[model samples]
Target: MCWINKIESIFNSTRCSEEDKVRFAVFMLKSNALYWWNVESVAQPNVLQTMSWEEFVIRFKTQFYPRTAVRQMEEDFLKMEQGNRSVRDYTEKFIEYSQFVEHYVSSESRKVKRYILGLKPSIREFVIAMDPATFSLAVNVVEVTERNKNRQGEEKVVEKRKWEGSSANFRSSASFRRPKFIKSDNYSSKQPPARTCPRCQQVQQETVNPNRKDVTDAERQVIYQGISLYLKGVFNAIHLIIFGRTTHN
Candidate 1:
């Protein structure tokens, strides 16, 4: 009976199906002892040489198997997000298996991520309303909200004003501070009349219109409006194009 069992074992080992072989390969990788010498590559050279039929099967569920699976998962995730591929249409397929992938980006895979962008009010309200988190998850979420209160406020204000209208307020900060690069004394000139204005030749019109002496207050208003609209349109067009290119890229 012992002799027969040994013969049967040898026969079964050689006759293992390809699925069993691959599964065995996965198992062998999981054993750090099995991979003691070589791990730079995913392949299991030691398994081919020393593993018995049963030991290989045991190794498949050990620590190293997931790493191999993750590598394969990463390749699949990259192909899904290229330009021609619509993110919504194909992203679902990748998302279902993304957790299996190795080293996928936090924003992409989302298993372990530092929240760079805080959730919007609408999203937060929805998450809180829906299946409330398990106790631990709830506590962590509250902690995150507390820590990011200032950042969240900034994000909300930015979103609220980004496109409703142009944000015209200048940000005055230390970034705007100048140390008087070329110092000038605060003194006034006493003399004038190097060149007389071609139109307003009598009164001092150094900063005013030289070619329109008879221009009335109403005409000035019209000119200012036209110039303001033209400048606004130009600046708006330039900023719009810059934003569009940056977003698309």
Candidate 2:
């Protein structure tokens, strides 16, 4: 019917002659037919020939828009369900299907009830609990519910990601604080302190005065002993800082 009205408006507004208008209208209708039955009906030359544009439209409606067809559309509307679609999409489908039975569900209350009944169970309870008496109110409630549900889901995801991120950070910090074990060729529970030569220490200090002779092998050994003592002190400091444990002498 809408298609017929649109085509009629176009021809009526144009300068096309009555004959041209009827021909164009029939051509458009024939070209738009979907099934083989429709195609065969439109292909019949005598079907709508010699009729005015207005008479052709009347005949077209009489042939296609039967009362039984409207009843079938109403039955299809009753069987419609939201299924797994989003609330918004389901609402659109509900409105689209209701057009067929718009005359039957004339009152706001009936439209509201019919629309809500087809909604998914997840949102249907809350929508009904609001006790919406009109179709607009029911639609508003469903839209709000969908928005709030989406927001809460997003919040939960964000919270979970934050918790996981914090846990990773804590583990990273703990790893930095963890002690490192030092392995040696002769690993022992305790390490021995370096031995220093007091005589060579005094000799080296005296030799720096420039009044002493060249250092002897025994004095040089003392110098090496002093170097080992200094290195051992450094190793102990490092072990305490990194491993939080002291090397026992």
Candidate 3:
């Protein structure tokens, strides 16, 4: 079928005569195709001389592209849908399949309708609403619609990622800026609290007498011992009052 189309394309471009078109196409045949053509020519010697390009195409398709295959191609074309294919890919397939089922897409309106029906629903709705009169216009509309839908999906994904990123950043920043209060077991270790002796109410004041210069060294030592004992008793009283225990003497 591709070879047939290529031959027709060359014929159309070069404006070749019918005889030249058939000859050139037969000349290009190779391997199995060449063998089949040789056998067909021997069976019908005058076929090439009498056959036009159109007649040659008919005979070639009858031999290689069987009726059953053509029918299956037509069925496939009728059942075609966009499925997971991109709009461009779907369009290319539609064009290829439509060639075998020309009766279905004989008119521009029918061709456009068939093409639109085969598109994915998301794109089909917009293309139908646009009501394109030409097959090309319909294809263009569907392509644009598909692109827009894809772009919107990508944008939604981007927005969701951005939102998640911002939420993560906000949580991190909040954790960083928030103050944490830690509880310590040794609260009084750094600076001891001031406590006064309950019995004294005031600290004891020690005085030195100038007249002590005439006193003996042993008498002065006895006075110092008495003051030290009194101060020790005062501390023990303070400790007992605060801690429920007396300091050892």
Candidate 4:
């Protein structure tokens, strides 16, 4: 469907909160951008009966990004399901509804992005599908992870390309030694070697320069370990590179 009409419908929706509306909107926008917007994905990945675009889109989101979209859709349904039902009586039903959706949180990207946008025609034509309590819950996951803060500094997406059997960025970047205290406690207290990466297994004793134009194999490993640390939540730190600050729960 036209994107603008969908927005009008949601905005006029009195039952949903402001947040659900936005979440539904985002879900739609992202879905259209990914699936219907792309051609090859149209034919049935499954039963290929020359699927109508809408039927294919819904099925795709349900099978793939259901957590992203279906979970929210389910939430919206449950809230309505319970709107007339009493909290005291329908509490168990509510929990069941939530559990049903949460179980699918890890659905593939196709489904997940659809959920994020609420399946608008532009998007939904791609799982266009939301409610009051449902909308609140939509933001809750983001809040639990706390990914909603205003960004600081530059909004950047660093792309790493593979080259010559090593990540090009890691292979060529200079290494930064940790401070003395970190070195002592974690890195075996070795003093920073003058102008060279001591961690590298030196072979044939070529003159190792810390400022070498090309990083030795050791530097690439260091970069890999550093990324692993970030993903593992080893520490909450604000690098000037990401957001102004890295937050931890």
Candidate 5:
């Protein structure tokens, strides 16, 4: 198949005669190909001498390329879809496979319609609306559509990231500026003064009793003053520690 394509390219470029094309192709055949040609020539004597380039191609393909493979190729081409392939890749395969099914894409309109039908639904809808008259035009329209679709997807992603970033910043700022309790120096003054326990009063009465001879009056008075001062200091310290600020009144 590759050799035949090369020969066709040479003929197109050099404007070679049909006889010359056939002769060149036959000369290039080697090994098993050459052996096959020899056997063919024997089976049908002087067949090459009168054969045109087209006739020679048909005979060559009949010998090398089987009918079953050609039929399978045609069937696959008819059922071809873009699926996950990119527009350009699908287009290339479509062209390659179309060669085996010439009748399916014989006209430009037929080829364009077939190509459009095989495209992804999103692209196909727009292309059908445009109604391209040529196969090339249809391909161009779909390629542009695919590019625009991809660009839109990228923009949406960028926009989503920007929104998420701003939300994160807002959350962080709100946390940083949150209000906290303020300590005041006069907080203790708002509450009533601490009360002395009944037990302390009873002890004081016992210490100052007239019958008791453990201490003199002046010494009892001094001890009573000391106990009262100690209790006052303890209550004041507890209030200051718990409230963070306090005032003496």
Candidate 6:
């Protein structure tokens, strides 16, 4: 119906002649009528032979959208919910169903209330907190909030992927360019050769021993020599005293 209205508006805007507009409308309707059995039957040569565009639309709408169907549409509108659907999709669905009873939902306050009631809980809370004055304002706020949330979620995912990729690349490149272990000729030359002489080796062994005593060979020899010299001097002094006494008697 909206598409038909758009075509009609284009014809009016371009100032097409009434005869041309009628011809175009009839062609479009007949061309599409074959797809639907009811439309094909209703759009027969005799029924639409003398019908105008307005008359054809009225008849078509009357046949398809009866009073019962319009009442059901109103019920559907009342039960509509935004659950899991995007705000734009929900809005389009609500508007399409509400068209059947636009007279009742004409007021801004009523429309706003109905729209807010159908929104998903998360978005509804934010919108109500904002307390928009008009239905348009409510829609704008909800849409913006949902878009921002979606954008942030996408950014987080992208950041995580970038971090993972960078870490993997760093590991791969580090493995490829690592410095190899090359044995240098000068490495062995820099270390001193081990001592081979018996005396030097023994000294080295003693120096490295953890349990060796603290006394040295030079200190023991000095102590023994001093005792021998003291004994010899005492014996000579005794002999000299005895001989001198005997000669005096």
Give model 4's TM-score versus the native structure: 0.16
What residue pairs clash in candidate 1, if any at all?
A: 27-59, 27-60
How does each model score on lDDT?
A: 0.48, 0.72, 0.82, 0.42, 0.82, 0.72
Candidate 2, pairs of clashing residues: none
Q: Please provide, for model 3 over 169-238, each residue's C-alpha lDDT reduced to its tens digit, 9 standing for 90 to 100.
A: 9888856576776544333232323556679887544354424564445545756887889999999998
Which candidate ranks first by TM-score, i.e. highest? 3
Q: Which lDDT tens digits does candidate 4 get at residues 1-249?
A: 234345546668756654455344435655655454344344434333344434544554454555667557576743433334333333344333443455443344422342334321331231222221343343343233223221311233222222443665565666643446323232243233444446884434343344554654555467577677877674444344355444431
Error of 3 at 136 (Å): 1.8
Those runs of model 1 whose alpha carbons end farther than 4 Å from true positions after fitting are: 1-69, 102-249
User: In terms of lDDT, which candidate is stronger, 4 or 5?
Assistant: 5
All candidates: TM-score: 0.17, 0.47, 0.67, 0.16, 0.65, 0.46
Alpha-carbon runs more than 4 Å astray in model 2: 1-62, 66-72, 175-249
Off by over 4 Å in 4: 1-32, 35-49, 63-69, 72-249
Predicted structure 4: clash tally:
19
Q: On lDDT, who's better, 2 or 3?
A: 3
For model 2, residues 95-192, the per-residue Cα lDDT tens digits are: 76565576757999989988888887878899989999888889999999988988999999999999999988988896667788655333233233
Per-residue lDDT of model 1, residues 1-249, tens digit only: 122234346558788564455444434343564454255234655555555645543343244446577567666665543233332333344445444442454443243121111234433443364433243353356345544665788898988897444433333455556766542232123222356767978666343342465555555566688778999999999999999899999
lDDT of candidate model 5 versus the reference = 0.82
lDDT of 3 at 59: 78
TM-score for candidate 3, please give it: 0.67
User: Candidate 2, 180: how far from true, in Å?
Assistant: 5.1
Query: How much does each candidate deviate from the true structure in C-alpha RMSD?
Result: 25.7, 15.1, 15.1, 31.8, 15.0, 18.5
